[model samples]
Target chain A: MLTYFVTETNWLNFISSLVSQYRVFGLIDYEGELKWRRLNEANSHSITITKYRSIQPIKKFFFPVKEEVTAEPSAQKTILIGCKNCDLNHLKTTDSMFVGSPVSDPYYLKRRENTIIISSDCDDFRKTCFCTSMDEDPFPSKGFDINLSPTRGGFIVEIATKTAEQLISVRKHYFQDPQPILLQEREKMRKRITELVKNNNSELNWTDPQRIVSSTYNSKAWDDDIASTCVECDACRFVCGTCYCFILSETKDIWSRIRTWDSCQSAGYARVAGGGNPKNTRAKRLKNFYACKLVYRKENFGFYACTGCGRCIEVCQGKIDIRQSLAKLKKLEKNV
Target chain B: MFKSPYKSIKAELLEVIEETSNIKTFVLKPEEKFSFVTGQFVELSIPGVGEAPFTPSSSPFKTDKIDVTIMKAGYVTEALHNLKGGETLGIRGPYGRGYPVEELNKKDVLIVGGGVGMAPLRSFLLTLLEQKEKFGRIILCYGSRTPEDVVYKYLFPEWKKVKGLEIMQSVDKCPVGEWDETVGLVTCLLDKVKVDLAKTVSVVCGPPIMMKFSTTKLLDVGFKPQNIYLSMEANMSCGLGKCGHCQLGHHFICKDGPVFTYEQIKNIPEPFA
Candidate 1:
């Protein structure tokens, strides 16, 4: 790993240089909401390095909402920037689902292989943010090609992978040895952001989420509370970084096979012909969705599926907060 | 880089056998040699239409051709039924765990299949018959909706002639025809057959309700959960298990099993539900 201090002006210039070589995507303000957009020479100045997190997760870069698995791989290289820690953690779950074992998804693997990831620290927290409750930090500790921590007038950059190291070596003059005082300031900023997240999510009860969720399989809170408010719009699943369940359909003419994002909340997700559906009711489907995040995925993939990005909370039309639901599940566990 | 699992191998439809009013068995010859053990399934794709999982009904030993019996119940199958011989389609696997025939060598076997569920069981039966001398008595109790819905009707007479094999069939109702066989649920046939409960391994595949009721009856007849196998089906998109549509609890029906012993999946939240 190589650490350097790059001035804001030089950092923007490096980004501009990379934009000419790779398709650079970063966070920018769109209608007051931070969303991912391609960073070009014209808009490189407006790119934010300290946004909480992008509204759209980094999943779309590697696993698009829809793609043809049999199609040719893209030739252009891609660089994703300004990714938060929560989205980076989600890469772990998606990796296991798409890249592991007896069979792997070639489409996702191709995109992942052709892309470089650049993550940044979160300087602030949203009202819906709850990564700390799920035992994840707001800033990434690992699993990125490059990491940027906002400093006074520049970025404390850490090159974690050989790909990033090679990319920076081409424009080596822009990077300088970090001063010890600036490094200390960067560490303080990281800690302050972590504390802010913990304090913001303090009201939510935290426990062994896996144990609580497994024991509360029959909890009335699912039907009596969560189910009542859930509109089944599937917005949360669509926005989630780790919800990789997909449906394979053909075009109307039947010439091409298409793989598109699917949601468990949908009525037909688990339904088979002759109408045998395990998760038939909306309440059961909602319960299964949470169980997938808390229990089922952990048992299968060795980790909780939820990265606690809070995107689901923001997009949910029913105002049904997953943090609140997990808290309620904990209370129900105690009652039982 | 490994080849994409989603890529389907081409197979030419050799012949179509109409098993029932709405069900047809399409015999296909893969462009490449495809081999699978009895009780395994393959994803059949109609180029532009879509793909769905169907276990080959043909004997695994007959590598030249494969049989897939489909019911005209869904959109994909509806498209499949409209296809003719000499047309090309795609096939992906021999996915999921097949029946454990090697373990059942010296044990008596009881197979119960209902409706189109008989397709996979047919493969199991034909394979078991190839080495009939190695196993004890094989009893198959099949049921369907009506006389017109009975599949493999042409093969029953020949199957009865096998040394120690017994075939018993029942229909839920007898239409306006000369129906001489049993006219009750498949579970009723279990009472008429005699077997040493300690030595029998039961395999069942059917509609959800039939499987549930038949499993209860099998239990009532003293069949151990470990000795019972089920060919479970769900909406499978990617036969390699990348797609999560076929997931049941922590198990991927496309990977962990399309065939699981009752004891293996009994504790999972909703195996039968």
Candidate 2:
């Protein structure tokens, strides 16, 4: 574990230098919202290089929206910047399914192996964000090549992996040993941001998500009211950082099997042939979606499927709030 | 080099047997030999069309070729039905948990299948027949919509001749013609036969509603929940269980089971539904 201080000027120079060797992708302010974009020679100036998590999730970096699984590996070396702890935590869920299985997903494994992740600590929280409720820090504790903590005029970089150490050694001139005062300031900033997120999500109780969800399976709170608000557009699932369900379709031209993201909210998601649908009703389907995040996933994978990234809330057309829904389920749990 | 679960090996269609108007049995010879235990399924793929999971109806002992009995139910099946012999198709897996044949040794086995649900059971029956002397009495009670709808009708005569085995066929309703089998639900056939409740290991596969009713009847006839096996089918996309389509409660049908004991999944809400 090595720590370094890269001044704002040197950080920008480091980004520019890396562009020649690796495909560098970083968060940029796009019409007020942050988005992940490739930092080319032309767009390098617009790169935010901040602590904000992008609107687009990190999932697509490894598992694209649609990818031909039968194709040969591209094996492109990539550098990802400004990933928050919430998005980085989702890799654990995906890794359990795609990598930890008896049959590993070569596509995901190849991308994961080649990509260098530089996680940034969040200084602020979105109104819908609730990472604290999910027992996650605003700063990443693990699963990153390097973690960046923003401070005045520079960033305190903590290298967590051999890849990141090698990356810094290659561009060692841009980095210097951090001062004691700078390290203290970085810790204080992390604590303040964590407090803000905790205060914002105080109303939502996730102390026992599994217990609450199990008891509230038949709760009327998830009835017509919630069902009516959901248009079944599947925007939430598409935007979710940890949703790994996908449908495979083959193209006539390429003759390759392509895997694309799928949502449980879709009518045909759980429908078998001969018109058998277990989650037939909209309310039932919605319950299953929530249960997957709160209960089912924990039972299967030993962790909640949701990373508390708040992308689902931001993307939902009907303005459905997961925090509010979980609070409601908790209320129903008390009654039950 | 890591082997990907999504990668499909090429399998050439060797023969096509039209069991009924809508149902066809495809016999495929894989470029690389694909072997599977009884009651396991494979994801059959048509190049342009998509893939769907189908249990092999052929015996595991016959590794040279595999048989998949499919009805023209949806888009993938429709595309599969249009294909001719010598055409190449992609095949992945032999996935999911198969039947526990070792547990059935020296025990009377009761197999009940309805309509095209008999496909997976056919494999189980054939495998059991191969080791008939190791098992006790074997009873197969099958039901179809009509007399003409019955699959593997040609094999019934041969199946009956096996030692200590009894085959009974039933049709829900037959056309106004020469029909020689019982006319009623498969559950009705249970009344005509005496089941060794304590010793019989019953395997039931069919439409959801039929399976639900059959399990209730089997229980009423004194079969233990642990002894009854169910072939649970869900809409499966990834046979490797990465796709969440086939999730039934906490269980992934593609991984945890396509076959589960009644006692194993009985507590899960809506196990049949």
Candidate 3:
């Protein structure tokens, strides 16, 4: 809850100071897309805080697209900036999948332990963003070390953990105690962005995703329009923040084992070695994906797997919109 | 510095028995004493090839060496079958819940296996035999494509000699004079057998289609869903449960099962598939 004021120039200097010790990555808005780029002391000044999350989730930092499971993942001390609340909240699912499982993934755990997350508020909104619909705010309240709230001339840095406090302690000159009016400004910015997200998603209806998904388990919508458009490219799964499925492969000489991202959207995901797949068809596979995201995950992990980032909608190969699928399944008489 | 569970432990192939044309039983001597309960499986690997999950057909009581019965069906199994003997292989696991031996004590245990599905059951059967006096009648009904495709033909005589155990056999068809046993569907044996349905528990393992038909047959023959056990198989990549390949609805087969009761998973769609 402790808030501080860091001017635009002071904030850059503070980030630059840490470059000698930590590998700092900041959001660089370029070519109409916001991407995470490594920051040295020189490039730290060029780091631009974005209003939304990047196309890549924070998971790629922990669970890479491919890694050698046979060796140790580099446990480099690092800091990540420009993480939105949607990006931070998605870790609830990924953390449990990687760290809280019966056997933890060593690579993911190592990276998680070594990284310090600095998330930011969404001063702007994306058309596809629907965090408000999933009971999430545009700003982070937890699962972050420090959160930056963009105000008129600077960022309102809210320190949440001892690590953040200690990290800030070394560069105390860059920060000043926030004025009462600046605190109000941060809250106002948050409210405006939340409203923007809500308005953008107002047209799409399923208030209770859990109920709607369960009721539509046997709906004709799955086999109807969905079957034709779904090419099963697995783009949605690969870009998702919560899809943690992976497959293991051996090197040609068997000297190493590589763990690569695998998606259930693929036909052979649940196939047995003997040529039997429970989710054989595209319809069955798509149903499984939705059931896991909305119903089964909540049943097992006590939370929905979808992060509400709307990345799936953007990256979908077949131009299939999940919102349309829900609308098709929705009965006019019942909200579900 | 935490060690990854994906890494397979070195194990030397001590011996190999050619069970049939495609089916083979491998006896492995792991560098360490790898112990597992009955019905639990291990990820076996052929050095330069790949890994596949299989239940140890050897007795759980035997820790010095492990036995796995593999049919040459896929890439890894094909590589495994090509090995004669005395080749170094890799293994990881002893994952998933094994058979509920404590629950089966003093109760009649009926085992239904189809073809290579008999591999995991052999471990469960051996465990029961070791303490056969502690349980009631143990019945095994097995069916294969033909007499030639039957695995562990050498063990049937030894099993018949054991007290409190009854074994039956069936084949899909008889090729002229190739067979002389029960020639019909395995479900026929399920119908003919006089089991005290009230006190019996059944464990079924086979190919997907066979598992489906046998489960329906068990239900029809007066067996309760809770009493029937099924050895479910999916594409299990990481035996430690992090990789999500072997999911059966909300439960991961590698962690929550490989062994599940019919009552536990009857609700999941295409569970046997």
Candidate 4:
């Protein structure tokens, strides 16, 4: 790991150089919420890197909400910063789905090839954050070109790729070789934040998510308890970092086939041409979400699709907490 | 972009035959050579409309022209039904695992089809007919809503001539003096199909309910679960299995199978659904 200490001002200068060279998308605090915005020279001057993942999952950059599958999209050299571990980790699920496992999606492959990822350690986490419950760390140990940890008057920049070293540019003189004290501070910060996240999820009843989820397929909670509360606004899926289902829509003239975000919750999602819908009921649709994330994705990716980023909980219109649902599913295991 | 999987090959409409009130067979000549296995399907697209999946009714041996039997079921199919002839359409993918022809070799092959499900079975039957000496026996039991609803009527005579092949058809309720064959569900034909239960392999494709019942009957007669192949063609989008619309439990119906054995999908939740 190439570690360096750059004062907050010099870090801003380095971002300015990056913005001048390539299109930069970084998390910026907007109205008390972090939103990903393009970094211009002016915005780069005051860029505050929030370790919190944006409500939008980083998958949107690679597999867009809507894109023509056959057409070539403009692939610009880009830098994405302020990514949390949740954002970087979820890409593995999406990558395995889109990248060539016999057939590859070119639109997704092009964007994945062109962009650089800059992750940061989460010194703080939202109340709904439960990365610890999902068996993931709040801080990223890898899967990034560059990483940042905030300290008192400066940031400890740790880069893991050659591209990240080149990004330092003329501002390379600004980084001072870090002392041993800096590494000690980073270790302490990581432990404190991890403990805080674990403690937040201390009330979670289950530890083995896969076993609990697979056993709850026949649970009545989906139709009886959960379906009544859900209005099917699709907010939870939209904000989810790992939801990769999409529908192919044709343009008016049918020239371009557009792949738009699709939710399994939609009634038409599994409906056949002759109007046979396998997941016809809202209850079945609700069950499908858990089945895909907790069961299917885990089998395919060898990890749970839910990174415990809590964007689903925060953006949910029905006040449905996934943690509460998992507890309900666990209750099925007991009754059986 | 090396030939996007989504890119459609231009196919000129060569002929359109009205098979039923709502069903039509469009003979398409692809701009380039295209061939698909009997049980595999293609996404046919009208330039101004959209695409829907359909299995080729013609033989896999014929690559110069493909005969697609389409019914007016949904938006895309409605437009496909409206096409006359000589209009160009877009065709992509002969997707999914087609009928395991090799697996059926030398085994008694029983085809059970309902309504337009006969489309793909026609292709499969024709393929078997091309090499008739290889298989033990081939039986086709097809049922439609009524006499008017039955498709591919003209081919029955030609199909009946093949040695070691038997054809039995039924209509739910045919008009008086219009039909002579057995007047019952297609599953009724399974009762009369005298094949070695141990050596017979049955293929079923139909409405969800018919397939469900047919599968039960096949199991009742002691056909092995692995020998009962089912064609599940429902809710497929982006036929490459990436779009995730065609998921049945963990399996993508468009990818892992449009053709799956009962043993492969029996435990999956509502396999017939």
Model 2: chain B TM-score vs. truth?
0.97
Best by DockQ: 3
- Residue range A1-336, candidate 2, lDDT tens digits: 799999988988888888988988988886668899998877776677655577788999999998888777676999998899998888888888788555778888899999999888998778878888888889988899998889988899999989899898989999999999998998899899989998988766657777877788887777755666998999988888888899988787435678889999998899987677998877888888888888888888788888888888988888788788777777777786
Fnat per candidate: 0.61, 0.65, 0.72, 0.66
Interface RMSD of each: 2.2, 1.8, 1.5, 1.6
Q: Write the per-residue lDDT of candidate 4 for residues A1-336, one digit (tens) a residue.
A: 889987888777777878877889988877657888899978877655855777778888888888787666568898998999999888878888888755888888888888998888998888889888888999998889988887767878888988878766556787888877888998999899999999998988887767786787777778888676788888888888888899887777565687899998888888888788889988899878987888888877788888889998898778888888888778788775
Off by over 4 Å in 1: A252-255, A334-336, B1-3, B175-181
lDDT of 1 by residue, A1-336 (tens): 789999999999889999888999988987658989888999988888776987798999988888877665563599988999999999998899898666778788888988899999999888889888888889898999999999988999999999999999989999999998998998899899989988998897676788887788877778888777888899999899998999887665444577899999999999877666899888899988888888888998788889788999999889988898878888788776
Cα lDDT, all candidates: 0.87, 0.87, 0.86, 0.85
How do the residues B212-247 of candidate 4 rate in per-residue lDDT, one tens digit apiece? Answer: 999999999898899999998887878888889988
Pairs in steric clash, model 1: A254-B48
Clashes of each: 1, 0, 0, 0
Candidate 3 docking: what grade?
Answer: medium
Q: Which digits, one per residue and each the tens of the lDDT, describe model 2 over residues B1-273?
A: 644577788899999999999999999999997999898889999877788999999999999999999999888898888877889999999899999999998899999999999999999999998988989899999999998899987998888787788988889997766468888999998878897777889999999998999999988888889999999988877888797899988888988889998888887777788
DockQ of 4: 0.66
Chain A TM-scores in order: 0.97, 0.96, 0.95, 0.96
Provide the lDDT at A173 for model 3: 90
Better of 1 and 2 by DockQ: 2
Docking class of 2: medium
